[model samples]
Target: MAAVSLTAVPARADGPRPAVLVLPGGGYGHQADHEAEPVAEWLASLGIHAYVLRYRVAPHRHPAPLEDAKMAMLQIRSESSGPAVDPTRVGVLGFSAGGHLAATLSTAVATGNAALDVQAAVPDLTVLCYPVVSCTEDVHQGSVDNLLGASPSDDLLREVSADLHVTAATPPAFVWHTADDAAVPVHHSLAYTGSLIRAGVPAELHVFPHGRHGLGLATGDPGPDQWTSLCAAWLTRRGWTQSSPSVM
Candidate 1:
């Protein structure tokens, strides 16, 4: 099983708290420190349980990471009725390549088998930060090569590109990208957002004027720092926050 570090606060007096599965992007090379524990801590501070998944990458490839993502979702859902979490409210958030993984889960359908379906591991909601949504032209080459290998087949490429797979059944998404990101172009998010809209799935997207790729939390970057606050508000709007709906 993939390693999952749980960050859970005490259960609220009212009921089970909502939770998020956080995936940090590293171009399928490794997980980012800034995007991992820091994000979990922030969510926990808001009374929402968080799980940081140290999913396999690089040498592992494709379905391997996806499988890990599914496992984490299954584990969280398994304890949904427990005091620790609200199964139905579980969601996912990812940065860059991790965003691609999260998007894959959002669009992936259940296979109808208990073990394989794993109770249909799709997240109730998704947040993609500068995600590499395409395996084609808009792709992040390093991430594509790492995940799908060099010279992947056209069919395989199409199959893995999360944007091409969106459907009305896919969960709503909140996506953000900086226009100046050279590594993973902003168009990736734009195209994915367009697909979501065409499929009638609820989606929100923000395109900032400047910021580089992999700027997790964009701490000191004034423009990108707003993303955190905006995302918090978006979460609140969906009632995913542990406390009453209010922007953090």
Candidate 2:
């Protein structure tokens, strides 16, 4: 399938590196500019090809963001970067609402069991920064309600909750959340990480104290600037940074 449309930061001709697919946070309303674009540009500067995904929201809910994310992955895989982007080295990075999408891609959307009329698209790994996981627990009420429609029931959330969907096949993931995130509670990442552990999936998680929610990928006040370095190192540890691209 062809991509609907995308904004890409091409790899430097000299040496392309692992690619990152970024999904911006908007509480299922709109794509945040700083979260999506600024982070992409920052990643590009670090020698990685960063793709900023402006996925659909609100009036287009549930499977819409999931479908758009899959489309983005499909587009990245379809390209032959010519010594650039080892397609398999591609990873998904999401924030807050976007983090839920990333977790969805890694667990639900990629699994081929989705009830949507969409392709099975999954990234090699997922990077979820301050993700919203369970609707029943640690719920980001606005995000969950917007994503599933106004009267979304508990069953609806049970069906879409990233934690509930994790399985042995779920892609490896790198997760982080601030203990002080009042917007989206820290339990979101904690619960999700617990599920990942129970499923025996390869995962790395970090819980930093004091950095509030929606920091994008930048440092807040002081400290935690090392988060990116920590993430980059985690990718390296998983051997995900050097994986060769493959046909979907």
Candidate 3:
């Protein structure tokens, strides 16, 4: 098992703050750097503590990444007693396959597996950016293969698919995707949002008409770039953001 790393960014305030665990997308093969630090810094600037998770990826499978995410959440929550983070307010922000991992952490079965520690694994909220949400037709084949192997059983496929796992227990989610995302189709977000809504879980989804997959911050692109502000507002509404106004 490869060692996982957690990079923490403290809030500017002196008091404990809400935290967001950032998971970068890499099609389940690797972690994307752009999604890690930049995102953490953004959250930190917003007066929210941020932690970037470097979880195990491909050459690893199902439970590995999920376990890593759980560990990251626990680490952040464990700091609740200190001036680091607020345990009850910890959330997750993930991109693409990392989004899948985030959603998995949000919806996967606990199974009383001590290693999983499901009770501590649930995040207060989730924000998924162009996430790979399904294992069936709308799935990103590369992400599916990397995370579940080339010929996964139907049960395995259904089990890992985030949309299929959504229930009333699933956390509220704020999702954004590009309508033109070729790598991972937009239906992933749409389906997951629909499931969340049907389950009576609050969900907000945004579908931009342009941009490719893995756009990261989407930098200067006018339309897709609005996600940051939109997400900040959503987080604020969910109490994941700190009491202060969100930073640009």
Candidate 4:
């Protein structure tokens, strides 16, 4: 079973608070540490309930990771889930391969399981950081191999290529990548953001000139660190955060 580590804030007297599920990148083989807890803490600092999902990785394959994400989303939105969060305000933030998973969840349809409410599993917003968005061009080979096996067919590749799945129903997104990201390439974000725009979903993309891939929060790095502030401001505009962007 996937484990969810919660970092919750006090319930607001106004109404249910917004919540976010953090998914760390590890190329679908493991979860990255830096992208997990610290990211959740930052969201919690903004007065939003945050949960870090350690979803299944390699040896699990395709639907397994996606299923775990869906289950986590459902758990977060459930009335009895222990937090006073607005079900309609749930979102996701993912990095690297985890960002691919987040995009998949945002664009995928329900699995036809009567027990799982599709609406509950879908995110209202999405944040992708240095994400792997394609299985074809500029593909992250390790992630593709782990999630779909070493020999994924063309049909399957298209199926998992997140940028190819965007629709009008896809959630609005905020995505950022370094222009020189050699690992996954900035084209991934460009393709996904373009698809979102074509689908009429609100989206934001930022390509930094420097910084290597997997710079979670880019803590000490001045240039890339601006993503946090920009994202916080985006969240505020979307009414997910009450804090001023400057504080981030």
Candidate 5:
């Protein structure tokens, strides 16, 4: 089973708070350290309960990581105590390969599994940072290889390619990437956002003029660091977080 660490805020007097499941990127080989706890704490600081999911990586293939993510979503929705999280307000935030996983969850349809509540596995909203959204063109080869093995079939690739799976039912998303990201490329984010627009799903996209791939919070750097503030405001507008006088 995957381990999930929680960073929860105190219960609000008004009602249950929104929560997010954070997934760190590592090309599906390992979870990135900077993207995990720090991101979770940031979400908590915004008055949202957050959980960092240490999902299974390489040596584990397709469905393993997805299954872990699904399980984590279910756990968050099922929690009745400890943290006052509203089950209906659950969302997901991921980076790189983790973003692929988050998008997968958002676009997934009912699996007809007897034990799993398919709807519960989907996020109410999604945030993808420097994500690997496609498995066909402009693909992150390492993430594709790690998640689906090196010789994944064309059909399997299409199945996991999130851009190809977007529907009107898919959750709204906020996506960001740098225009010059050599590793994953900005096309991944562009492709996904285009599909979202075509599907009539509310989507927001940001393409920074500069920055490399995997700039988790993009701290210190003046250019890409604005994504956090932008995302925070987006969350506030969506009612996921309280509107504050200033954003961190």
Candidate 6:
């Protein structure tokens, strides 16, 4: 058996499966149990390397959480002791406010020789699990206010709209949300997906009928439980998940 520390789990012994880092949502004020560990455990069982990021909360402010996300991705990408970690197959999975962070990482980053200590951290694919898609419209009030302090500037507003920052260089993404979710609204997922489509980037969206916010993968529930199967299918289609074992 191999060790998978709670902080970060590297690519496992079987092979260099697609590494997925999970960011749980706590609305930037708190980090929840359902948002982190469960997702990692499931991904690990599927042979994907899973890292659970316990990022700095609201008092930390913008670019802080974003940098933490970048650091995590970089650490995984730079690890070379075992199976080669495929930076191209790397995916960032976030839920709720963490979803917002994932969106920021996917949209706001650019590659260059000047890549900071973060090492040009950016996932090849992003998965937003019922994410907060916008900083201005369809926004989560507490998250935005906490991220910006008071009277956020127009610049700050644009900074948070990950969709607005999308470029042809942005990674492909997949999104899911329940239509009945009033907490974050389905529009967040819709708007982001719309932007991805308009930019000619590949995106897949699933809007479940029920299941409001924070319904982490569970049994006998009407929430994100059904998402894993669909996600596996999408990964297979994108050639991210393995059909048969092979080391790179």
lDDT scores of the candidates, listed in order: 0.83, 0.77, 0.85, 0.86, 0.86, 0.77
CA lDDT, candidate 6, residue 136: 81
Highest TM-score, which number?
Answer: 3
Model 4 has how many clashing residue pairs? Answer: 0
Q: How far is candidate 4 from the true structure (C-alpha RMSD, Å)?
A: 3.3
Model 4 TM-score is 0.91
**TM-score of each candidate?**
0.90, 0.86, 0.93, 0.91, 0.92, 0.88
Q: How many clashes show up per model?
A: 0, 2, 0, 0, 0, 0
lDDT of 4 by residue, 155-216 (tens): 88998888998999999999999999889899999999999999999999999999899999
* Cα lDDT tens digits for candidate 1, 1-248: 34445444333445777788999999998889999888877777666778888888888767878888887888887874444778788889999999989988888833334564553598888989999898876768899989988799998888888889898888899999999898999999998999999999889999999999999988999788998889888888887776565322
Model 3, C-alpha of 61: deviation from truth (Å): 1.4
Clashing residue pairs in candidate 5 (N, C-alpha, C atoms within 3 angstroms): none
On the 0 to 100 scale, the lDDT of residue 142 in model 4 is 94
**What is candidate 6's lDDT per residue for 61-96, written digit by digit as tens?**
776677677777877777776446666578899999
Q: Pairing residues by index, what is the TM-score of model 1?
A: 0.90
Q: With candidate 2 superimposed using the best TM-score fit, by how many Å does residue 71's alpha carbon deviate from the native?
A: 1.0
Candidate 3 lDDT score relative to the true structure:
0.85
Q: What is the per-residue lDDT of model 2 for residues 199-227, given as tens digits with 9 covering 90 to 100?
A: 99877888888887788776554554667
- Candidate 5 achieves a global lDDT of 0.86
- How many clashes (backbone atoms < 3 Å, residues ≥3 apart in a chain or on different chains) does model 1 have? 0
Residue 7, candidate 6: Cα error in Å is 2.1
